[model samples]
Target: MSSPSTPAGDLAFVVRTIARTAVDNEGAFGDLDAVAGDGDFGYSLARGFEIVLADWDTLDPGTPDEFLKKVALVISKRVGGTSGPLWGTAFLRAAGAVKDRTELDAADAVAMLRAAAEGIKARGKSDLGDKTLLDALIPMTDALEQRLAEGGPGAGPAELAALAASTARTSADATTSMQARRGRQSYTGERSIGSPDPGAVAVAVMAERVAAEWDVRD
Candidate 1:
């Protein structure tokens, strides 16, 4: 139940969480993507994480921004297809938003999420309700902001992250009924209605991991 309080620990947690998720749920994501996409989304992300895992020890323990930039570069280079660049851009933008911060508080997390959302939208030319990962991410950010606003003056990162995870999961599930308006799935139009976007599910999984791994801290 130990929680991360430093830049290196935080970066390590993200690496471990994503790698574990890729291992446990890659096939599931592939199956979901097959319904509308090329069925490689899962494999692509997993490969990116494999690169991340291989170079884990080399990741910067200095600024959070540097650590995230390294991860973003790995994803951009190792992962294939649109997801690679878009996800990489998201992380890169988020890292820029955080600048040289050594540790993230609730506000820093929210800012990073906001920057990530904007990055995804710009990189993919998509937005909320687009039946993409943005669907889950937008609602998750909204929920986190709401939680931070309503959790009173002493609002903690754990509660905000938990709310983000819950919102992401709910939004991801709701994507099953949505029609694709962006990405490879858009070619299917209404055919994507029954399957949740794999990217969205991936986002939800990441959020869930963050909540589970760091909620004990605050």
Candidate 2:
């Protein structure tokens, strides 16, 4: 909001927002996952992020990369099931993208997101059109990067966030017709076609939350 003042501050805000979103939407997420998966996605994510919030004051904030790595360690160790490794890897890769950078810009943001998506793709052995989170995440990142590149009208932070959120939502909704190709949902075969991928929906929801609160975040 109002252009981030510091890299550390921006990372703090985004992480806190993500953690809180996970905690707050546990029931909805769990219900979504139950359609095809084991229904533990929300539970696992909330449990891990709860620890993140509980230990917020203790997490290193000396630098953006350091903070993200610390968070990644916590996620990998505390989160259960597949969510742990995938999400942890995402944070780790994002941290690497900004390694030693004292400040960040729009390009840094794009790079971090790209790194995170690649990490998720590798860790989950999934890709776009796999009916996974990447379905939403990658498209969202591309939209943001493209918008920034175009520098079109209303290409500010809030607008870019809104664009990303919208793209993620659209992409997630499109997963409803796609048969699952990865994760527990794949076991359901055609049954997974009617329902959206929980991970994709989760990504969309988180992006939406971030966009809606972008201007108001401290």
Task: Candidate 1: give the clashing pairs.
Answer: none
Query: Relative to the true structure, how large is the alpha-carbon lDDT of every model?
Result: 0.82, 0.89
For candidate 2, the TM-score is 0.95
Candidate 1 stretches greater than 4 Å from native: 1-3, 215-218
What TM-scores do the predictions have? 0.91, 0.95
lDDT of 2 at 199: 89
Residue pairs with backbone overlap in model 2: none
Worst 10 residues of 2 by lDDT: 1-10
lDDT (Cα, tens digit) per residue for candidate 2, span 72-108: 9999998999999999999999999999987877778
What is the C-alpha lDDT profile of model 1 across 1-218, one tens digit per residue?
11367645665576568666876787888888998899999888889988887887787646678888898999999889998999899889989988967766667777888998899999899998899999898888888787777777546666666777889999999999999999999998889899898988998998898779784432
C-alpha root-mean-square deviation, candidate 1 = 2.5
Residue 186 in candidate 1, Cα distance off native in Å: 0.6
Q: Where does candidate 2 stray beyond 4 Å? A: 1-4
